[model samples]
Target chain A: MRNLIDILDLTTSEIDELVAVANDIIESPQKYAHKCAGKKLATLFFEPSTRTRLSFEAAMYELGGNVLGFSEAQSSSSAKGESVADTVKVVGYYADIIAMRHPKEGAPLVASMNAGIPVINAGDGGHNHPTQTLTDLLTINREKGRFDNLTVGFCGDLKFGRTVHSLIGALSRYKNVKFVLISPKELTLPEYIIKEVIEKNNIEFVETTNLEEVMGQLDILYMTRVQRERFFNEQDYIRLKDSYILTPEKLENAKEDMCILHPLPRVNEIAVAVDNDKRAKYFEQAKNGKYIRMALILKLLEVE
Target chain B: MTISPIENGIVLDHITAGKGMELYKALGLAELDCLVAVINNAYSIKMPGGRKDIIKIDAEIELNLDIIGYFDPGITVNVIKNGVNTKLPKIDPPKEIKNLIKCKNPRCITSVEQELPHIFKLTDSENKVYRCIYCESKAK
Candidate 1:
């Protein structure tokens, strides 16, 4: 009955419950294999995201559910000029649950309005991505053993990073959590977000361009790519790209137990050399993404 | 410009000055066979320094409710008769809004599809930002 369109739609308790369920599944994977035996998950991805699409498929598989739907708009009825609402309505009859990703923002919202099944927004343009927020929450819970009282540092493209915006909204609900926003001036978090979410919540947060300066103080370092195309001035992007790159030298000042994360398909933003570090949790984070999704699938299917 | 009071027409109130013309254009009032009196700078003794703008549209055709809601909610429409202000009912925004205005995000569901209703939730009236419920895209 619930739709996972935005992070705000999920209450603090619901997220806590999801995190708990995700952790339970992680602890005992064999116990939840047939949780969704006859259910089907339709992933209607208008845009291509290999990592996200694959994770959803893998999640459904692990939950003993079948996965259907397209990875791109070219493969779906959307190519035939079908409205999102109509596509979802037809798909809802065929599937028990729907996970949709479209280049258009609010595509899932449109789908949810018409679809009878529970709708999950996989990714929608440059807008909010709630499932990734769930993954991040599960990752933080798994690694740190708690979500409260942590100094999480977000580096690179905060302005256009939907995951960053969604995660910040999720974490703002936690206790004693402070955000250290590290990004280039051009790719800083949008003012509307800062004004609406951060300032309104009275959450402790700071904006700084110097990642090295604050590297030692963070409990979680989330690094995202800074693409050249996102820059209006090519020269500025070329200058700042290498500086945001996470190397062993950058981790020199970082906390011994600090965890580093990236919502994968990572370009050179994170040096592969840091993969061996004891604190590198991006790979584990990626795996946990599948597990949390498995938990989500099982929970949503049981509602019907 | 000087204009006499409409004998039988609708008077719009609380319209931010200079917005009447924009609404006029948006409504395409000129094309219609109606007497559209635009009071750009009218003397309002109620206001400080007694200066305000009022618009009087005298027409047989009824105003488009959605068009009014889309343009300005502050605008109050009153049906006038025999130099007396008659019933002035507020235009409530549609319970289920259909496409008319556009979402701020061009890559939103409302924008890409012609069939889907272009929906926006009025957020801050002072800022004039409508938050697209689907995408959370803010537009002025």
Candidate 2:
């Protein structure tokens, strides 16, 4: 069975296929509505989530599939110290697929290893959130129309933004994609990603703390929240919380078509006024998440 | 000082100088009941520094060659039976290792799930980079 623990788990062709399926679902929602009518999706969330859990439920519901599982660890058997493997193994019997989210990294992978059913990693700590990457990919594709030859600027906390890392890893596979990393030095992109994903791929990239300096050059401005949960110390979190804020003034120099994207629950990183901007696509991104997830479910379940 | 040759055992030769104790500790040779001799800074014509370390085991015990290969593939292994030496093929770094090293990342699933085996996959063989399969954290 196919499981998506990381964005790299899907090849470029597979990703294209998913995007195509997602677009088709968007075009004619009723055509694929009954595709997974008899299937059940088990959303085993061991951590708190708002959009992701709801998106998975909405996706499954739209596909005519039944949704069953907990929204948090306390609501599930995990609160009683049940292992991810055991929980998924038991759930596999009842559900045809699983969507898991956990605070600990690789919990879904552990689930996938034991789960007889296909598993999708909804989110896992700050390590990976491949579905979010897919959402961003769909947003970019719909807004910009192509993944190649775009100057993508990743602003704010690149260090703890699993979405940014996953998106960068995904985009590096494309041709002529230049990355403009804008973040404070303390919250810069991890060295391993720069060395392994960007440098190894020979992708052009420039790192800077100033967002405005490179704002005009970007075709896609991917803003990320400086997550307070990812910090070990309150002082560090407070110090970096307001590092980058996307506002109307910041968009002055940006291209008219520069698509702004964010994985929601954004905190104060994105200004409320920017939401009115035509270039703002974060809401659309969230909507796209449901459709892509529907496509992913259909693909994993091998439904016609 | 001359050490008595083992009648039937294994000889680990050409270990990088100063890594004999590390290899011994890694292999848990200190816990072994059989006689084990570690010769440090032994003159070697093949080694770059003209010095190497050699380990002689007095009993036929199973050795994890992957650990040895991860340490240094240049190190040679020899099986001695009835005072005759039989050199084995050169060791290669293992594609995957389990329970050898713990994932140091605090957020890694293995850290909380004590029952989960600490597994690492060789992601970059050229750099000998082994990363935890769970969190992709580099094995230090």
Candidate 3:
């Protein structure tokens, strides 16, 4: 009956439990192969998101559950003018769970409210992507082996990056964690987030425009792309698109074990050469997306 | 000018000056068939400016105290019966407001779903911060 519309919906203890389950699934994939053999998952994607949609499908398939529903609004009843509530309510009749992504923020919340089955917000516009935050958390836990006392640096478009906001909100819950927000003045982290999440939690943080200068101090470098879709003006998007390119030269000043992470769909913000560095874990982060999703599916479905 | 007292109605006293019309609109008092008097800039020693607004409803209609409290908590509610004060209602900022104001965030689901009621939940009571339930956009 529970739904994940926001990252804050999951408590730190529950997150720890999910991470534990994810690690267990990684260690023993076959043990969970048929856990959901008789279940069905409906992915009602009102917007196109290949990676997230594929991850959810793969997670369900790996758990022996059937995947149904459309990949885009045009392919679904939504193209015919069906409301999200009616669509999900009808889908709930066939599916035991729903994972929805919509271009409009809070669309999954609407689905969750109306649907009889549990709903997972795969991605909701620029508002919230709890699963991505979960993926990032699993990656952080695996990389640093702990969530406490790590100095995390968020570089690039902090303003529109929901992942950065969600991750910062998630990480702020742990003790002794400090944040280094590195972004252009125009795209700095939103003031509301800084006030509500950072300052409210009494977490230490420093804002900087220079990523390289603070590179060595970070235990985790979370880089985000300046999304063209989030901007209204094409000229502004073009001006900020290449704001930070994580070249290997920049890694020279970073810690030997400093983890480099990006919520994929990168557009030149991260240089291709840096992918070879041992610090690069964005690909691994993508793989972790599936495992954590599998763990989330199991949890929400109440499967052992 | 003298405003007559209602026999069986509610009186909202000591509203911040100039907020009478806003409270009247928010409370939908214009739609009421009964007499509703809005007296603005009335002299008041308690108010910081020594002036206040008073609303007198000449009917025994249910009032949404939360809305009134949100508009001005200092305002006192007096229930009169037979032209004598019978009861006093307490007020506080509402925990959740529905359909009172529309969510201005264009990305909010409520924007596209015409049937969805615009809902805001009080996230920070001390700061008087109300955020849209759907998109978490702070209310202005």
Q: How many steric overlaps are in each model, in order?
A: 1, 0, 0
Clashing pairs in 1: B99-B118
- Please give the lDDT score for candidate 3: 0.92
Model 3, C-alpha of B133: deviation from truth (Å): 0.7
Best by lDDT: 2
Go through the candidates in order and give each one's DockQ: 0.78, 0.92, 0.90
Please, what is the TM-score per model?
Answer: 0.90, 0.95, 0.96
- The top-ranked prediction according to TM-score is 3
Chain A TM-scores of all predicted models: 0.97, 0.96, 0.96
Query: Stretches of candidate 2 above 4 Å error?
Result: A227-243, B30-33, B45-51
Residues B2-85 of candidate 3: C-alpha lDDT, one tens digit per residue: 997689999999889999999999999999999999999999999989999999999999988878766766789999888889
Fnat for each predicted structure, in order: 1.00, 0.95, 0.90
Sort the candidates on DockQ, descending order: 2, 3, 1
- Residues A94-189 of candidate 2: C-alpha lDDT, one tens digit per residue: 999999999999998999999999999999998999999999999899888899989999998888888999999999999999999998777889
**Model 2, TM vs. native:** 0.95
lDDT of 3 by residue, A209-295 (tens): 888899999999999876667677898877766657889888899999999999998878899999899999999999999999999
Where model 3 places Cα greater than 4 Å from the true spot, the runs are: A227-243, B86-89
Instruction: Pull out the clashing pairs in model 2.
Output: none
Reference-based lDDT, each prediction = 0.84, 0.92, 0.92
